[model samples]
Target: MDKRLFKEWESCVKCGICRSVCPVFKEEKSEPYVARGHITLLSELIKGNIDFSEKEAKDYLYKCLLCTTCVESCPNDSHTDTIVEIARHEVIKKHGLPTYKKILSKLLKSRQAMDFAFKSASTFSPIFAKKNNKPRDGIKLRIEVAGKDRLLPPIAKQTFLDKYGNDKKSRVVLFPGCLINYTYTEIGDAFVNILKKLKIDFSVPKKQLCCGAPIYFAGNFEDARYLAEKNIELFLSLNAEHIVVLEPTCASMIKLDYPKLFMYFEDKKWEEKARRVAEKIIDPIKFLFDQTDVLRRLKKLPIRTTYHDPCHLKRALKVKDEPREFLKAISDYTEMKEADRCCGNGGTFSIDYRETSLKIASRKVKNILDTKSEYLATSCSACIMQLADILNLKDHKEIKVYHLLELIDKALEA
Candidate 1:
């Protein structure tokens, strides 16, 4: 019964503008799937017209991509996405998490457990996930656990943090996040290379954990808060001048959502600490863009590349131009149609609802193909993973997906 969530539920005028922009509605064409429709149902529940525990209500809640595109278009700035998250928290309070999700949450909380599991997964994943015939990026899996056609990048034998230890403290700290640490070490490798090439002072914090985006996004608010508290304390201890996050979602979660999490609890001390930490948090692309030392070294990469804006970077952080600034400086930049449109990754949404996620991603993939580019670049690792999967499924072996840092690292190599 959050007042802010209640306000958002009542604020929606049912304008249907959100309906037109919703990717899920485009695929499902159902009343429960669209933002306005979702708010409408939520409002009905608040008014006692519908039950919150109803399967229909729960299905509608989880079905969202959580892109916040609706917020971008909403005249009221209603924040339907925030309301949806709050509603999810409500649902979790009543039903508790499924057994698998509970186990996964525990894994996220432990460093040693995650390291062991991923180490095991790295060695055994190939046996489980078959390689694609046209594999350029990640290996595709037809296995039931991987869903119908999920393309998971091969796990790194040695993680970035494991390879590059925090020998001594530096002015800058890079937060590689979960996806980059385990699945997409290429981005992590590129990040280190770019920093080295630019002669930037940085260290990767070995103790830094997941930014708890997955937990919070999954409606495990308390667990998400636990993660945030741990990360905040560890970051404060490092006392770096800049904490450049590799994943856009991690960046936004730390910069924006971290403060909100504390404010709701009326924890003045933690909220202040979060704001201080937020000041130092920057996306790696933005960090590089601000570095004149790096700017002077940009080489015009002779490759045609198109940029896909991660929803977190574009909508949450308002960081649409920072990454593009790098692309414009280094590569033959092509603007894809609706470049800021959500690729339908929605964190684990792509895993849970594969067919719907893929259908939504088709629109984005078509937009990328329309650009006729050699490579697809984005700020978020999850976005890169999602785009790579959809492209692999379509048999587009020619195009490659890269993080902005990876592309920047390429320029430095050239």
Candidate 2:
């Protein structure tokens, strides 16, 4: 009921520019799915005119991707996404997370649990999930994942940390989010390979936990506060000059959200620690791009590549140009339409709202196809997975998807 939440919401002049830009609104074709409609509803909820616990109201609340596009596009800085975050936290505080979310929150907070679950799922994939020979290149699934396609990069039995997290003495800390850690271990390999070529010594601490974005954005603030402690303490203890995060979502969570999380609770000690950690957080792309002669070292590729902007990297962190500059040097690069649009992954949002997620993704696929590029490159692991899956579903499986680090590694080898 605070006035600040209403500050942005009440100021909306009913402009539908948000509808024009929202991937969800474009797909859903409903005002309720757009920022303007959400603002009206949220203002009412904040004022107690509407009950968030209503089943209809509850479903609509979670319908958002928290893509931050509308907030970024808002002329008055309406910050509808921020209101959604606060609303989700309020929902959790009132009725508690669903049973699945509780399980997810627990897993996200515990590295051991995440390691077990992902490793177990990797083990189970061969047994329960159907696989084809061209798994990475987009194989179809009978299980119907993420709307209709169950395609995902094969999970790694050996987590990146399990294999390479022991280089604990280096000046740089490599923080791979859950996807790069478990599902996309090869991305970690690529970063290490590139780092070795750049002669930049780094460490991947085995003790680092989830960046807590998954559960935190899912409405569990308590567990995120706990995770902030473990990760912040561990990173600060190493005295590493830089903490390079693989996934942009993790980077945004640690760099932007963690400080707010601590400040919200008025935990000054932890807030300071959070700020210290935030100071160290850097995108892996920026970290590498900042190095001397990085462009000179990479061998330019003849392969045509296009880039998709992950929402967190493009919007949350305002990281727009560095990746493009690096890519142009390494590959035959062309720009995709709406490069900064969401791939509809939104972590659990894609899982919980599969149909809408895939619909939004389908539009993205059309834009990608228009580029007619041989490869799609991006910074975020989640976007890599989501874009790859959607591309496969659309039968453009031959168009390979890769982490920008992987492309850099390929260039390094050349």
Candidate 3:
């Protein structure tokens, strides 16, 4: 058990303020699904008051979407996500990972293997991939895998790294994470175009792999640390002034979780290096916002849009205003109800608990409908995946979803 996290757990007052903000609790209305319930269970297990079993642990721990709303709502400001992650780590340490997690972890460990897998998936994906009638931004590929509908942006024929080799003269390094590299190349393309327009020297580091967020969230902190070390070395080798990421989750992981991963490292040099790397980490949206001349050049778009605040982007990184301010400047922006609310696509949370994930997502979709906006702009790719699916699932074709970068690219073109 993490001592710091145990202390943090002890501070929880069980005020149920977390219950009001928790998306899962709102949908499930069950104690186990809420932060207080899980914290109580964790406290019991830690104190030897309750027996820990794989089945019992998985039931409570995996239920969280890790949106951090509970933590934000709590008066004690307990690190619910961290506590839950530790609980997950303990559970996995005792009994080992399930079969799917083993396969996913292996894929995250290698870029070549992941590329090969996606290449294979791409070959067969076209057989089932269908174009959406009301495509908004990005190539909407609607497909059904095992009878479950998934709305994904078409995978790039070649990745951003494949197309844009490392430029030694570039000061900025663009970290196109797995989602942007494999599934949403348009987002990557837009980011690059925006950089080009800004005349900001940048490179896409080919050696960099997934931010290891998938593995970390899976409770495989051991492998997550290894992946983080690999990325840190790659960035250190570049000596780039800034590391820009489009996906908020990847940015949050590198900026927040990467250092946490390094805490276990005994070597002071590596820990110092991790901190250095964290300093250079930047969100493209925030970076672009800082470039005043770039904003002045963008033509105001006439499109009406609503913004979905990605939980990690808003709650974790506290990047609430930049995207909205940028959107408001570029387009006629309207605020959606509970814009910072979780879209219920907490990486594997959606995959593992599909019914609960969709239940939460339905409310999110309804909120989007309430906005009556033609476009839905957000900072996180995970949110994009969930928003796209729920919109398609409900057959609500009036609005199309976009990454904020895509919108910036549009404004730049305009």
Candidate 4:
């Protein structure tokens, strides 16, 4: 942890300005869960004024969604996300990860294990669907902690990496995040098709792990750093000029979090490797937009879609225009009110604070509905899942949620 960065973050005035703009704070109306309060807590920790029993520290650190909205809103640009991550790292160093988190992180470390689980789930999915009378297209797997009724997208039959393998023609290394790989292979397939059409050489590494955002947000920074190191090595081995990531959260972790976390490495070569990896990281939409002839081809599609800017993509990366431009090319696109607002699905934040998450997503859904869009498109896989779950519950079946690349790919196919 950079002591100077931590000190800067510790000096927040708690002026409540962050609360005024924070979606989570807006929904909950609570300081404890707001960015300012989180910084104040870290301030106390840094000053040696309070001891965080493992549970207390874990709980506080886990409350953050790491959406980067607060950073955008802060006058000082206090780097709340960095401070939170550092606090999480400290906690994990002091106390080992919880049992469930440890298991999940372990599973996330192996693509083979993730693939096996997805295949198994896909095989049994039909049987379970028949027994429960749930439509195969819309299956809700109940995870107890997040809430039993939380609807999950069904697992894909084959991961994108499995289907495409590592083609030498592919100059870029694409990291299809866990959700995009296992739950929304259509999005992954669409991305591949677009890449093919653009003739952008790309490779999907066989051993890529979860970008580790979930574990990191859950206060398991040891696992997060471990996954980061593994991923850094994997990308370096690929020897690709660039790394393209489908999920905004994963991209943010690679481009922002990994370098920050690994900056203090004693080995200069490892630190240099981390920096090189960060440079090559590109969000899928921006990459697609840069290849504009693809967009020119997309301009002929007949469908209409509206976009939801995932907070990570919009506020964190400032990638607000690329998705809009991509959508405009293909369809009669409508910009929803508050298009860049947080969908409240802050990875595990939705699980940790259900009501608040839903409140924010509910507002987002209302805006999507108001647009009368045939499809609601976003760049983040987790945003798609969260918005879909909310829309499903509200019986808003007419509007579909999809990744932007899926829409672009469909246009190309037409």
Can you tell me which runs of candidate 1 are displaced by over 4 Å?
1-7, 43-50, 132-135
The per-model lDDT (C-alpha) reads: 0.82, 0.82, 0.82, 0.77
Q: Estimate each model's TM-score.
A: 0.94, 0.93, 0.94, 0.91
lDDT of 3 by residue, 1-414 (tens): 324446768889888889898999998899988999989987776566886778888888898998999988889988788778767877898889998899999999999999899888777766657655443433344544422766666666787677785646468888988988887878888888888877777777778888999889878988998898999998998988888987889998999877766654355676688889999988888888875366777789989999999988888878888888888889989998988889889998887888888888888887888888899999878788788878877888778888898888888853
| lDDT assessment of candidate 3 | 0.82
Question: Which tens-of-lDDT digit does each residue in 19-58 have in candidate 4?
Answer: 8777867866777778888888877775678769987886
RMSD of 4: 2.7
Q: Stretches of candidate 2 above 4 Å error?
A: 1-13, 133-147
The TM-score between candidate 1 and the true structure equals 0.94
- Candidate 2, residue 289: Cα displacement in angstroms equals 1.0
Per-residue lDDT for 131-171 in model 1, tens only?
65332457765566757676777778898879875846889
Checking candidate 1 for backbone clashes, the offending pairs are none
Kindly indicate the candidate among 1 and 4 with the higher TM-score: 1
Cα-based lDDT at residue 83, candidate 2: 70
Q: Which ten residues in a row have the lowest lDDT in candidate 2?
A: 132-141
Error of 2 at 404 (Å): 1.1
Better of 1 and 2 by TM-score: 1
